[model samples]
Target chain A: MTDPREAGFVGRRSDGSLIRRPLSPHLQVYDMAQMTSALSIMHRITGVIWSAGTLLLVWWLMAAATGEAAFAAVQWFLGSFLGLLLLFGLTAAGWYHTLAGIRHLMWDAGRGFDLPSVYATGRAVLIGTAVLTVLTWVLLLLFWN
Target chain B: MADGKTVHEAALRTPLGRVRGLGSAKSGTHHWWMQRVTSLALLPLTLWFVISLIGLAGASYAETLAFIGAPVNAVLLLALIAATFHHMAAGLQVVVEDYVRGELRRKGLILLIQGGSALMALASAFAVLRIALAS
Candidate 1:
């Protein structure tokens, strides 16, 4: 307890014992009126999902380049129930991550740091992802043979 | 300040000197900046790719080949692949660094991720070239 970390706020209790303290806006301590924390975590989760999604894309592209037979195998799997399920999840994660990324970029530019805008943008990302994922699937189904 | 790094009036070194190496990594922000840069590129590239993919849903092999053979599609596909692998590596590095407590494990995982991303990007780019040039 001789040293203090920058982010770890420590305090002395009434009993004179040292305890790791949390400053303001800590999730459990703070009011739940703002959903920003949940959205922030989801941004990371979807980003991870999108990262894995790149491998699937790579697989598809590799197969397409290989030959007709190779490509057919990939298409067959992709059209299957299991493959389609993964694709559906990827689509939703992709849309969520995409919207979250835009929100992050705005944050980088210092545009949406205000409390109201933060909540608004979080909800917008949720709704946008839902709408966009549905539209993408609809478009794909319309062309499905 | 790092943990257990106590500063006292009797200490010879200033606060800046005491915490010099414990502070920010010199190129930490560069990693952050690159993440942002690649993400910005991905924004439009992904949108285009998704739309093109949907449009190609029912396309025949020959049609798909012809589409990818187009200069614009080939180039964009390459960009998309490059950006994707680049972004993924950067993003994963952050996650691993944040969560993995073992110093050795973190470094090993990061090296693996970077190497794998480079290989995957090269593989995908090579595929695009083969398709674009062969046809």
Candidate 2:
């Protein structure tokens, strides 16, 4: 009689250990060779964050529509430290998503696909997002009274 | 006769014969096409939104509301809200697919995103209408 463990389905490695499948490809192996891929991924990331951030927008709108008391409650929430942190994060995500979207539009229009140009544009997107976010916050602080 | 039968012959065919021109399932193409279309529409709408917000800067709540209540502004605001939520739903679908590996979890996320976006879009439209229609 054939032993159950000797079936072809039950296998072992040369060293007498159970064999395992290789791991799936992940971020560690992600190639940074293309600007479009980077921007596309970043856009999705920002989109996800922005989706969640819409809760704040809804809160503000609903409060404003309800009454001054509700509005004040939202204002209080927005003025707190935690609120400021969330706002900063949302601002950064927005700037990054928008600038990267512009880059994507350019590529979609048949421009800036060369190797050197792609890398240069990717760097520009990163710097532009940072600059825009800083400028936005500065203007908000200086003018939003 | 059995020895002569090939694997192809063993396959079953229904009354809806091979000649019946049943096409591929193409429901997803509409979602893909609409997302791109809305993205293009939003390119201009978003720019207009930024400009409008800038012009309304430093204005009081009443002033801002009045500005948004103007005919052109009201129409544009509605369009922006609709397009934005549609685009957002599409984007969130991709994000859900990427992050949620389990079948049930992925379906749940998709349903949540779709339902949430639809509700938000309707609510925003109602709010805009209220502001626009207030006498």
Candidate 3:
């Protein structure tokens, strides 16, 4: 019997290399099947957003260290419309990442792996992030007033 | 004499074969450890940061400088910056590895995140030192 690996090949190149083999297990063709999949994807997405936010944190720290004029510039930007939008997004990402991290910790400890519990907790995490983000902003506004 | 095994077979064999302690990548422990460590550190540091920001808000530049120039404030500020950046770097590295599939791209992004955080931390520390030492 012909070897399985060699059965499909018509011929080899002059240099004796196998020609144009198909790559297996393409990611583009796979479907996200459940809530867990969605959360896993979002976890990575929020991570990038959090990374960008860290730069802002550093900027704030450096500004605080500098004198009045420099610090004022940082304040002005933060208080502006665009800055507010970014801050809002960052806040949401922060809460989302925090909640997700807790969920992962639970999984690591071998809890919440069952279907019903996983789905329930996943939904809770999604809703919790939004609620926490809004509450944070509300608290900020109330206290800052 | 036994027939010579192929290259793949040779690679599979070892002096301590089968019973050796060699195992899969164990870096998960490191990641888990750092995440918890940073989270613990950030709990207090973050609270201090928010309170400090709120207190300093709307204050004049000189007054703010004076507040930071205080030894205790300066030291705390430095510690917070260091811990925060380190935590951020670790978090970003995981992000890059998860999303960036290509080996070069993933490694490059991780390096950029780490390097950027380091630079920012250094710059912030220098500025803090300047304010603390200035008359």
Candidate 4:
């Protein structure tokens, strides 16, 4: 009961006592260049972003179903500067998550465990996401215009 | 003398596991499986959706509506809607479980994620249906 090791919380004692302990080194202290940590954290973050972005999808669909004017309003907004920015953000998130999911699938199959390839693939995911996003927008501008 | 020696049995559960009572919620495997399946399904569906959206971008309202009304587009859009939401819910649930502290907040957030995604999926499906069936 006296030892802090048995306590779950940082500043707590085993016998239901509390003590303030300094916070441990966190994100600021971590080396983000290490692909493993950075990519894992990015996966969760983009997943969260995409989760919130799902509402936009719903809004678009509902607007379309509601009426022409409703659909146009949504479209006009999406076609605006801020809207494109938002869409671009979502696109980046989607591409990042998709690439990361593929990387995870490889890991799940035990394919990319080697350190060199892990770092290589990590770099590839970042590069690939950027390439995909830009390529998509280029195609969109070309055809959709 | 050998029979008189006492034997100690090894504990099956770890100390933390026993304290937690339930080793796992047991739904994690299902969540993992579905996330993978939906992710795989989404790979192609998302491509199709993006391409279709780009194609319809500058078209008139009717053109866009007609695109969704097309049989193949309607079916794929419906699938995309369902899979995307399911995937989002599963992924977000993991994120919430990892970071959202407190029993009430965690459970409440998880419930909100599940319920909100399901509702959106259903609404999106109905919207696609209205577009597909109206014409």
Report how far off residue A106 is in candidate 1 (Å). Answer: 0.8
Report per-candidate DockQ: 0.42, 0.19, 0.26, 0.37
Q: Is the docking of candidate 1 incorrect, acceptable, medium or high quality?
A: acceptable
Looking at model 2, the pairs that clash are none
Q: What is the TM-score of chain A alone in each candidate?
A: 0.77, 0.75, 0.78, 0.78
lDDT of 2 by residue, A1-145 (tens): 1322222233345765554322232345567565556676787789779778878766765665666687678767877899878988988997787777777778778999898898898899899989978887776666664
TM-score of each model, paired residue for residue: 0.83, 0.73, 0.71, 0.82
Local accuracy of candidate 3 as per-residue lDDT tens digits, A49-99: 876787787676578676567788987998899988998898898778778
Off by over 4 Å in 2: A1-28, A31-40, B1-25, B51-59
lDDT of 3 by residue, B29-118 (tens): 676577667766766776676666656655676777788789999898888788778877887776665445565777788899888989
Error of 4 at B9 (Å): 11
Please tell me what DockQ candidate 3 reaches: 0.26
Error of 3 at B62 (Å): 4.6
Query: Model 2 reaches what TM-score against the true structure?
Result: 0.73
- What would the per-residue lDDT of candidate 4 be over residues A1-145, giving only the tens digit for each residue? 3433223324444764555443332456679887788898898889889888888888888998999999989999999999999999999998999999899999988899999999999999999999999998998899975
Docking class of 2: incorrect
TM-score of 1: 0.83
